[model samples]
Structure formats: C-alpha cells, structure tokens
Target: MVIQHGGRPEELRAAREECAEELGGEPTAPLADDAELSKFYDLQVEAYECLVANGYSPAPPSTREAFVASYYAGESWFAHQPAVPEGAPIPDTVCPQPMLADIEW
Candidate 1:
C-alpha cells in the first residue's frame, strides 16, 4: 500500500498525516539509497544494461496484481550494481559542528 503523490515538504507532511489518520501507523520513508548514496553514477551502468535487455521499452501501467504478474514474467527491468568504484573512495558523512574547538583565526 504505497502512496505515490508528488508534492512539497509541507504538502507531503499534510498528506502523510491524512494517510496516517486513515491507515493508523507511523509513515515510512522509502530509503532506497541508504546502501550506496555516494555511488549513484557508478551504479547507472548496470541499470542501463537491464533496461536494454527487455525489448528496450518502458514499463506499462497496471494494477498491483498485474504488476506482480508482469514482474515475474521475465519482462524488462533495471538493477544497480552492489560495489562502489575503487578510485572513488567513500566520503566521510559526519555532520559538522557550528563552532570549532581550536580556532586559529
């Protein structure tokens, strides 16, 4: 049960609240890029390959039941690679503090 509405932060928040009222639970953000947020460009190669394999066509509109059937029917699909590039080292993503302990200036 995924809601695919597109909107701004305030609008999205409002929509989430409305949804929570009807659904009765905390809303979950789809954190798809948690594993390889830094290596997005590198992963695009594998996705391109998969897209080219399945008749090189875009996905068709369908219901949840139809979508599941289409998915398992060996239709065209995309997938990203697991590993990051060797030369492009992973970044240090720590949040910076407002004031430094030892200021020279």
Candidate 2:
C-alpha cells in the first residue's frame, strides 16, 4: 500500500524492532518463525503502517492491545463466514471510521 503520510523509514524500523523485542526476539531478529507468528507479525506490521499513514505516531504498549483485539475479532468473524463462490461480485461496503479514533496520540 502507498504510504501517503506519517512516519519516516527509521521510525518504522524502530517500531518493528520494538515489536520484535516484545514478542521475545532480539531487536534485529526476524519477527516470525512459524505460520501463526507470521500471521501475527503481518497484522502487527499492517497496524503500524496504518497508524503512521493516518498521521499518528506509534503509541507502542497502548496501541498493541487494541491492534491485537481488532485483528482477532476480524479473523474470528472471517473464519465463521462462508466463502463466496468463485466469480461472485464483491460487495461495496462503506468504509468504517478509524479504529484508533479513541486513542490520544
């Protein structure tokens, strides 16, 4: 995705390092070692990118809980839903407001 605004490369890098540490890795080590951790890491990175792209600085410890909650909620909902038939037209739903709206950045 295009990063239209917020966060320099160095800042994103630092955030990744911090996330790695919190997940039981060295700051410079890879973020994932298995499929489950890979999924978690991917979501975490996406959350970080979305936060910064929306012009909010990373809030670390506070943001982490919300991100994890949202990710799992979405995942659970998706897991229970039936898959669309191939070639089915996708629905155009209204985009929701920012998930971080309540956060004091």
Candidate 3:
C-alpha cells in the first residue's frame, strides 16, 4: 500500500493505522520517554529562537516542566503559537515544523 501510494506520508500513516486495527495495537507510536520529550521541547525553543533571530516576535516559551506537563495532559503546545502576527504569513523556509531530525537526538 505504501508503494502503491508512492510512499507518501498520508499513505504510510493510513497503512500504520490499518495494521494497528488488525493487530489490536496502538495506531500511533508513543514518545519513547521524557528524554525524547525534552529533546522535542528543546527543538521547539530553538525554532522560536530562530524566528526571533529573523526578527519575528514570538511569545516566550513556558518552562520545561510546564511544557512536559502540558504534553502529558494531551494539550497542544507549540512555540510558534501566537508568535506570528496576523496577516503576516511565516514561511516554512524560516522554520519548518520540527521533526525527529530537527533535534540533536
């Protein structure tokens, strides 16, 4: 199925979900541990810093503890939230969404 879809992300995700349903497993992978979460948070902070360096006025980030707590509570947390001014689009070239590759991990 992935090959049929040319390995597109949506296809890959759908495949995963289908497999999970059939195998009675989670449809999505969970974060490995707190270390991984910290790395993700660090990358987000770094991205916000990049935006600032490029003269974007992003709101300050919450403390790491708060971030972790929020994440565990299933609340969305993003550094770019409200940092972008209305009517001024932020380009992906400035700071694309952070993935595993975006962190030192």
Q: Top model by lDDT, which number?
A: 3
| Residue-level lDDT tens digits of model 2 in 21-40 | 67776545343224443355
1 versus 3: better lDDT goes to: 3
Model 2: how far residue 26 lies from native, Å: 34
Q: What is each predicted model's overall lDDT from 0 to 1?
A: 0.38, 0.41, 0.72
Candidate 1 lDDT tens digits, 10-94: 8788788878887896856653232232233223333334544533332322333333344435441223211332323222132
Model 1 lowest lDDT segment of ten = 94-103
How far is 33's C-alpha from truth in model 2 (Å)?
8.5
State, as a TM-score between 0 and 1, how close model 1 is to the true structure. Answer: 0.23
- Compute the lDDT for candidate 3: 0.72
Which lDDT tens digits does candidate 3 get at residues 39-63? 8888888888888888777667888
Model 1 lDDT, full chain set: 0.38
Number of colliding residue pairs in each model? 0, 0, 0
Which portions of model 2 show Cα errors greater than 4 Å? 1-33, 59-105
Which of candidates 2 and 3 reaches a greater TM-score? 3
